[model samples]
Target: MDEIIDFESLKLHTAAGYIRASNRCFTCKAKRQHCDYKYPVCSNCAKNNTDCMAWAKGSKSPIPRSIACYLEKRVAQLELEAHRLRTELNPEHLDDKENIAANLSSKPFSGVCNSEKDDIGDESFGFLYFRSSNLPAPFDCTLHSSDRGNIRTFMARNPMVDIYSIPSKIADIILQNYLDIHLPQYPIVSSEYVRELKSSVFEKRNTCGPYEKAVMGIILAMSTATLSYKGEKGALASSGALFSYFLSQILQVEWSDKLKKLQILLLVAHYAFSNPYAADSCYAMKEALRISVEMGLHKELDFDHISPLIMQTRRRLFMVCMNMARHVFSVNKRMFPIPSELISFQLPEAVDDHYITDSGIDLSGPPTKAAAIHFYRFRLYETEIYDVLWGHKSIKCGLKEWVQKMSNNLDSWLSEANHFSTINQLKYRAICHASGHVRLYSRSPRKQWRNREDALLLMESVIKCLDEYLVNASTGWLAYLMAGVFHVEELTVCLLDIMWNESNWIFDHYSQAYISTQVIQCIGLLQQFSLRWPDIEKSKMVSYLSNLHLKITSQLEHGFVIDPHIISQLNFLIFPQVSTGYGLDSLPEDTVDLDHNFIQMQQWNDNFTSSLSIL
Candidate 1:
């Protein structure tokens, strides 16, 4: 027993020494080991600027409390520094490239503005691309199983949607991808997806059957509703009312009604996604409202059973009508002169269902409620696309003619000399001119005339009116960008026409010619607006011009080479006027007349005609 106790005491002493030795800095701890001695640190630690704490024979270094704490604090600081460096390197911070890189070698906080956003985490999660020009198969395949769980799982893995974020030019690619990739095996969308869409409508309702029933009614209505039909007349009144209800909900901004309608439409789309006109419910709803409005059905529609899909359909239709009205106003303002005394028409009872409040409220009072109805009416007008460059040429022409006739004697009607004039009266002159020009331009070239000076005056007036209107009216009232783009186009086209025709004649007249050339250059900047918005039809026109340009250059180089003698004679006829002012002898006195222009114009016209004949 005494011998065992002595052995235990010796083992305890050896353990205590081992722990003490392990707890020292490298130089102190490796006293027995072969760590090279150096001043202030071990040779390895001196080179590294750190205490060597790596594992040694038989054990990891038992770091000293003071030294361990100091090292821990330093490690934390270094980790923070490294994190900042990595952040600077990350592509997510590209928006702050100039600042991030400048401070990269410097301290994180130095020279960096506190207000700067250093990090912008990804919000879009993911997206796919399909270029507009690419010819690819459509990806329209679905998951093989119709089970709700399986379909939801598949969508979670790879959600399908229209590429609305991309340019519409590339929308075709997305559509094609959908057709090719997902449509084959997974043809039918599960009913569960359709049911999921039900949430977009009718949230507070106690029951939701009327909502679905209303949706079905709208689908049947869209397929069968007609203007002459009335419910009592046995002409599918349910469908017409459904159509009317949808339009009213949209125009009135009835969100509850819209959601209900949306669910029905989604179900329709789900069932008939492959149908060409499956998604046309909105279009039909739009048509219904437009026709109703045209017929002046102010209060003759019902909306109690409006569905969500029908509501969307009506909204789209309302937008289309507004767009049409805008096109009319923009292309030819005279056709839709902001009316002075707009006739107040009573809408039929069917059209009177208010989506904004309890349907029980009576609105049969005087024109006091006129302001309320008028507010929604203006929305119909506001959706007018101001920058669209392509549409019905014939309609635009007709509109131009209408404006011309309406504003024929504007001086008599709009003269400031009238003592009877009010503030609005004085404003009508500018309004009339602006609206007239917009309407005129919306039409065909048949209405196009050579009155560049008059058009310029109208365009200038428009700019002035727009400026003043911005100051006086509410911010949301004026379409500043639209007005600017339109004014730019108007001013530019006038200048371009002048420059194109008068370049050769006035090119040498430095003062006048310089002005003309400068105008042409200015027009180039305005033309850039064409690229800011998307319009397939207008884009096609631009593409056509580009192609034609190449074709013309090719032809000019290889074909239709001019005779040297003709060129010389032409120079003699035209160059003298430019160089020595001698060609003034050849120009006719009646140069301002059409006859003079005809002779010069014939050259280009003949070229075009010849080209067409050859083709």
Candidate 2:
């Protein structure tokens, strides 16, 4: 027993005159060997000249605390490296889409999922884009079987929708509304064709196709809902009430023709732009996007075998789908999925639907509804601008030279036929003109602006759009609906930056004079548009524009330079909200047009600016 005890004591002796350490290197832990109790560098690591890092796994709490902590940190490092490798390996990532070595200047249109995101100590989670474009589900087979647990599609139905067989007198009102309001905005469906068809359909309600009835009901509902002004009940509720009746008729219809179904959905989505009333509008817009893509509307396809009328309708409908989808995603603040480059479809011929037949198209007649031809052309050009800006994968799009070139391209298109010889011609031309300038105005706030003269032109263009709306109140509402009012607020904020914040491109006395005059005219024009379209008064966009126009113009009038801190305060007024839009689209008749809350804030800015010395 004494000999055994002495042998155990000799075997348990501490190495190198050190007590047993509570920690061990990963190599010793793995090899099942004892580690030297040493600091800075363990005796085993020093002797072998190896790393003293720890990487161990244990379910029991008997493992050394140092090894456990080191393993925890090592696991985190491995996770970070894994994430980086995943990001680098992801070909669909916007950064690596072009080539392995290529560097893109434009940020990924938005953020990415955890695997692709840059690591910042763990927390990364978001949407993942797995396709090059908005292709159909049939084309995108990358999703795992387990990932696609279920599918939820929005479908509206109402059996009682047949009750809205509008009387002839009401039919007359609805038809005129289509001609005056709907035609200018869409112009895809022919007014004469629809008018004659509605009469025939109403007469033969028992015999006509469900698609025809559905089409007629949707158009009439959209027109009437647009023309009707609900005072305090909110435009959304009023439009929702109006749409509930028509939608029931729509959903109950047996839709066999896929193209017809797409057209009806586009119509509903278009109405949502003017009055985003219900969820169906948003769903209809999304479905339209999907159907148009699957049907190959965005891609060039051989359609010579199709009928002439059907061909033209396809072209017009696809254009409406592109523009309408953009507005939907933009307002909802979702990253738009449909890439601009995928659009290769040709514009429809400039002629009436009556002139087209099963054999071919003829543009010889005096067609009154050719406004859509021009609108489609504009949308095509807009797509070109988007693509051209993003054409060079390595370049930034906010450059002034590129913007000026694009703006010139638009002007050249409008310069082809500027004469407002007809109401249809005038309405579309003004819309295209204002839309082009607004596009320029949108780019003004990025980095360094182009020039004050260009800024002045953009401001005049906005005012000019409002002027047209006022001049042709009957159909001028088309211009009001085309571009909307969000950009106006954003552009005014740019104007404030140029006039005071930057202090570099300071407007000359003459420039200041015209800017102030145009600024006031812009507000005045909006106030006038407010009388007809209450959204002009109800939007925080217009409120910010009005108040900023007041404050910024005063600084110009009184010759005051803005302070940095004050500029920040004014800029904070917009923030994340301006990107989506402002307040309610429509307001009560008794609702005060002015933003009284903003007025008090502007008064505060006025006082602060008042104390500053003149330049």
Candidate 3:
């Protein structure tokens, strides 16, 4: 600069020039290409848009150093920092940083992760370790090693050791009770076979295998339970436990005869209908359908070569299974497991137990046989009605026409049923009428009528059916069980809906005293049932009925009239309210007459009125 040298004209030439060495410029050296040593720039660097820095000889080089040394230094510094963090976080592992990193990566994460500062302790170190590591942590297990071992051991133990063997006399008593009470409705096992089993000696009485024994055990337990065995509490608990254990055994065993397997399943389903806790009937019916298919029970058999009793038994079993399956599906609103097209068997023969001899079933048995046949027909019609109502199948007509047709069918079924014995006919007819009322009640949400006459009629019919059932409940344990367990809840629900919900227009036509009296009578009937079967207290229905009874009694005693607002509040406490089409404005004027005998409440009313007189 002092000499005023022309820096623009200055050329830094290498010793190997005029044919310049490629190493004269940085770009030329990196590319290993020839460079034209032009003033202030080289041709290759200029063409490639690269910085041209010439290397100085015997002086410090003008090029910068590589970043590899700086990167190594920074990595050393990070390692030292990580060691310090590990020592501060986990002082126990300060001797081995590598092991600390491995343990941190392997530890399971137990809390949420965030970037915010945490309390300075082991927890903070855990956060730091998680942030530093890129590995996924495992979840904390709930079961301890010893607990898992215990479960394995428990499952591996022999289940047969838990079998509860009842004395032959007690078993016979229970079986006899079942035969007298439940066999008429569920007639899968032959009466003759049961008698044979009962009369045979203890050592030689092993007519059935483990599955059949288990089935017999469950039936006996159910029968004893329904009868409300007043024996020692230990005996009752043992019987209940025995039944559960036997059912578990039955579930474990592989059945060989499909008919017997289906019989067990159907019996279980029937038990479920009467008992509160036996809600697995649907699952059992599903399995029964699967087994039925495997055994080809849906196909019509060649009866020419088969024994008539066997053929009849097969048909009856199939029909009962179908009916039960239909009932389960209808209650749960599930699709039927088997398609209708697959079923080809006819209805069972109209033969009585007396005619079902060792030889064959007498086709021309007693008139009761006709009654049984009519009963089966009613059940079949019930299944069809359920299908139509639930939309499982399509109907050609509208809802009104379909309901009318079904109603006509029910009437025809009742007329045919009347030709049978009086007791059986009345019972079956009551069941049919009750079913019709239930259907109408179920459909009331969709179908609207200005008049409350239909609602009144339905209530009367349901009450009449209840009265009939209650009157008969004393005759057999089946009636008692059905009334206390099933009908009580149904009638109570219907009565409450009729009394409380003004939408039904029941209170519009009747006075508050009349409706209160009706409710009191219904409650009295429930009280009578509860008194008859003290064991009904175990049922969920009993709890609901108890609460409902207390509420109604308190209200009627306090002279509270049934109002819409009060009922709406009470509805939430009693049961879930469903939306119906009838409203206050839609109610018609009172035009109906109350049937005094509908509820059989004459004696109940007299007693209540006399009590009030005394008070």
Worst-scoring 10-residue span by lDDT in model 3: 131-140
The candidate with the higher lDDT, 1 or 3, is: 3
Q: 1-615 in candidate 1: lDDT tens per residue?
A: 112113343344346553222333544465556555332245566566665542224443333322222322343345345434444444565456333323322332212222232322111100010001100000001111011111112233323321123354332332333223221112112122223323323332344344443442333333332211233123223322343343222223223332233333332322121111112212222222223232222221235665433332334333333323333233222122122122232321212222222334244632222222232233233222222222222334454354454445343333432322331112223443444444333222333343544444443443443444443222221112233333434443333333333333433432443444344433333343233222212223233223323333343346445335333322332221123323212232212311122223222233222211110
Candidate numbers, best TM-score first, in rank order? 2, 3, 1
- Candidate 3 regions exceeding 4 Å error are 1-181, 199-209, 219-254, 302-310, 332-339, 352-372, 392-405, 411-429, 441-445, 448-450, 469-487, 500-505, 517-615
Winner on TM-score between 1 and 2 is: 2
Residue-by-residue lDDT tens digits, candidate 2, 423-480:
5344457555675665555332343344566656755676566565545444333333
Q: List the residue pairs that clash in candidate 2.
A: none
Query: Tens digit of lDDT per residue, candidate 3, span 1-615?
Result: 121112221233223231122336655655677767653357776777765665434323333111222222233345445534543444575434334323322332111011111112111110010000000000001111111111112223313224336676766677877676456556667666566545542345555556655666666655665554354333334445555555555655653454665677777666555442332354456556544544455667788877777777777677667766665554433345344664778877666566765478776775333444555666666666656654446779886677667777877877766654444333446666565555554433244332365566666666666666555444432332332434444556566555555433455666656655655565566555543233233222344444655666566567657645545434432222233322222122221111111112112233222211110
Prediction 3 TM-score vs. true: 0.52
- Superposed by TM-score, candidate 2 places the C-alpha of residue 478 at a distance from the truth, in angstroms, of 5.6
Q: Looking at model 1, report the run of 10 residues with the lowest lDDT sum.
A: 129-138
* TM-score: the better of candidates 1 and 3: 3
Predicted structure 1: lDDT: 0.30
67 Cα displacement, candidate 2 (Å)? 54
lDDT of 2: 0.47
lDDT of every predicted structure (CA atoms): 0.30, 0.47, 0.47
Q: Residue 532 CA error for candidate 3 (Å)?
A: 12
